[model samples]
Target: MTADDYVEQASEIFVLSDSFIRIRELIDDEASTIDDISEVILLDPALAGTVLKLANSPFFNYPGKIDTISKAVLVLGITEVYNLVIAYFTTEAFKKINANQAYLDDFWIKSIDCALLMKFLGTSLGIVHAERLFILGLLHNLGELVVHQLTLEKHTACESNDINLLPWHKQQDILGFTFGECSAGLLKEWQLPYNIFAAIRDQDIDDLSQYNVETQLLYIAKRVMSKNQVFKGQSLDYSSLVTKEQLELLCLDKNMLENAVDYCDLERLSLLAILNPRASMLY
Candidate 1:
């Protein structure tokens, strides 16, 4: 297999919902009115239920209950509502297969932790379109989900005792790509915005010349999220992967990084409980 092979396979992975595709198209076209967006959202009953649940969740902290999609949109702002909708739609993209439940849970927990931290850091830095930044953070690792799914059949062949040593990326390499590369390709095929594609692709390391401040913030946030002591085993050092010049370009500092981690730690636990109450209870 080659990079092209992996890209082709990734492109073939069916998105489960046509409504999701339409919603992405509408938002990308800059749907301006609540009515216009609401009409699209109401097409999916599951999505409508999620929007209402999210609006009333502690994340939003609405004083009163929100019953209608239109009211939820009004209270949450279109950008926020859009972000929440996407988050809900995409949250289930990763599901545990025969992989160790503990490992899968931990991976998702870290992903959510990193995403929330990125969102907080982006907002605190006064980045324009912070909500989009949050969405990027949330969806940045979706490529990993794709890779895991694509290779599931192969992965199951490993002896149970040998599973830990399976070298996941080698499978990707054999299949001719990395999940990051495959994911970026998928995002491009999906026609998502340039910022999102750039954020995920460049997240491996900082390249000041290619990406702007917004993209750089994502790089920093991913690193910070990875380094959380909870994910110490999987964390990579951004300083080594990124150049000093790139760090200087982004105006990154230890203080902001620390603040982001502290905020994400609290919020991620809450989000986990909200998103997967049963798993939260068990773990």
Candidate 2:
């Protein structure tokens, strides 16, 4: 199917939950208070639980526990709470697709890894609106979900795995374009933000000059997460995933990159344990 076809399909068939829709509206309203947003979040028990977990997680580093959605709001602030809601909300949206639990877990773990790093690098590198990058990193592979839902069974049944085609190209072979392209299209339809959809589309661009720092953050997060996911459940140096050139682009040195790599692992499992408490396979 064409990229347009996938975008149309996702817009029509892949519905965003009501809670997410309200939360999105809440973020846009200059007058929306923490209570207004928290009331909406509390309506969904699942979203509340996840939001509380995130607020309590090292991601926030709140001094005391965040037991209620309202407290989570107070601790995380309006902007941060909104960002966290979008991250979890978008995750639930794609989980409705037909990927099996095993596949979903893998996807979840990888995306979380990328997201954690984006938050880390964006902050350390002094990028404004780092919270937005967290959302970008989490949803970076969304088009992969669309393509996987459409072609996964057949793609797996194919006995030959092309050694030469890059993963994104292999995706293009299966779908009309890469997941990044598909993600941009869907985000555009959702009317989220221009820079977000624009940066999502720029992830695969080879030339750094073509991307602003925000898009570059998205690109590097993907690269590091791809490598880190492969190295999961094994003992290996993921520091190699952070190269000198990638560091230079971020105006960071090797030490910061390595620290971020280490932090990715340290936090990935902790976040996974809380997010996917039932999935023992992550062990």
Candidate 3:
């Protein structure tokens, strides 16, 4: 099927929460207050529970407990609370699918880790609207889900557990397009930001000089998370993985990359647990 066909099928494949749309709009409004966000969230008990659980989780690193949704928004900031809720919602987007449980778990863990790292990296670089990167990173690989679902229908022989080749490469071979291209189509369908669309479309650029720093940062964040998941034993040698010009372009030195690795190491587990609580309990 063509890219348009894939996107068209995606709308029917996943059901987005209406409250998510309202919360997204509410957070974007300049005059929005914590109460407004709380009210929107309180409309859905599931969303409210997710927010409160995460707010009290060690991931937030807050001392006292955060009981109310309003206080969660106030302490976590509107953007953060919004990102967490949306990110969690995205995690639940594809339940009751016939994919390998292990593969599905890795896909989400890596997505959340990369998105969190993107936010952290964005803040260090003083990039505005960094919270958007959370969704950007979370949804960056959504096209893969579309393709996986299509594959499940016997459209192709792509197995969810298959890892002989990278996912994007396999997608390119099977669907004649990379997940990046597919994600671009889906993001456009959702009417997300132009910068996010551009960044994901170019997140894998090998020629770092051609793209902006934001894309490069995403590439780095994705690579770091992938390495952490796929390479737990060995050390990450950025001297070889990251080019000198790329590092210089992004104003990132060895120290920053190392620090990010350390941060990932410390936070990756807690984050996986908090973000995938159900799966966390199983494993």
Candidate 4:
């Protein structure tokens, strides 16, 4: 099946709950207030609890307690809160997808690694709404799951386990499109923000000049996660994978990238505990 076919099939099966839809509508409406969004969030106890947990989690590092949805909205801002809500619900929506648990676990770990790195790096660069970058990194590779669900036979062939061979090229060779593009297609179908989907759509490209800063940041984060030898229990090397020009584009140097990777290592486990249902079960 093609990318669109897989996306269409996945959308039919993996559906977002109505509460999230309502929350999106509320965020879009100019008349909606914190209490208005909080009222809708309160109707879903699990979501509300998750929101509070994330507000208190190291993700935000807020000092005081964010005990209520209204307060969470106030502290996290409506857009950041919406970013978290969608990130939460999107993961929840795909929790039970038919795939090997081990494979899925690895996929999610790498995704969270990329996400935390993106958030850290974006924030370091003073980008607004860096939380959305986290969501972008988290959701970037979901098309792999979609493909695994729809066309199980092709899924294994799509993996580029070798550090030298980029996964997107492998996917393009096998599936006629990169998983990033397929992921973007799925997000577009869900009516997500244009920037979110578009960045994912072009993240794997060689050229970074045409895309926005968010997309460039995502591209860098993805490369770090992809080429991370340390994550695979090997020695580190960025000399070949990340170019000097790329680092300069973001006004970042090798040390900052190293710090971002270290930051991800520090934060990945905690964030995964909150985001990954399978991992959360262990706690």
Assess every candidate by TM-score.
Answer: 0.77, 0.85, 0.80, 0.94
lDDT of 2 by residue, 1-283 (tens): 6888878887776777878888888878989887888889889988888888888888766789788888877766777777777777676677578768887787788778888889899989777656557778877878777766766764353212232344666666665577899888888887767877888887887677667887888877887676556444545443544456766877977566667778887787777776666453566
Cα-based lDDT at residue 57, candidate 3 = 65
On TM-score, the leading prediction is 4
After superposing candidate 2 on the true structure, give the runs of residues whose Cα lies further than 4 Å from its correct spot: 128-132, 153-164, 230-246
Worst 10 residues of 1 by lDDT: 158-167
Q: Give the TM-score of candidate 4.
A: 0.94
Q: Candidate 2 overall Cα lDDT vs. reference?
A: 0.74
The alpha-carbon lDDT assigned to residue 161 of candidate 1 equals: 21
Model 1, 13-70: lDDT tens digits are: 5343677777766766754577878998998877888778777865555699899999
On lDDT, who's better, 1 or 2?
Answer: 2
What TM-score should be assigned to candidate 3?
Answer: 0.80
Model 3's alpha-carbon lDDT is 0.72
Rank list by lDDT: 4, 2, 3, 1
- Write down the lDDT that model 4 would get: 0.84
User: Taking the tens digit of each residue's C-alpha lDDT, what string does model 4 give over 73-163?
Assistant: 9988998888888888898888879877777777788888889889999999998767668988998888888888888878888766566
lDDT against the true structure, each candidate = 0.64, 0.74, 0.72, 0.84
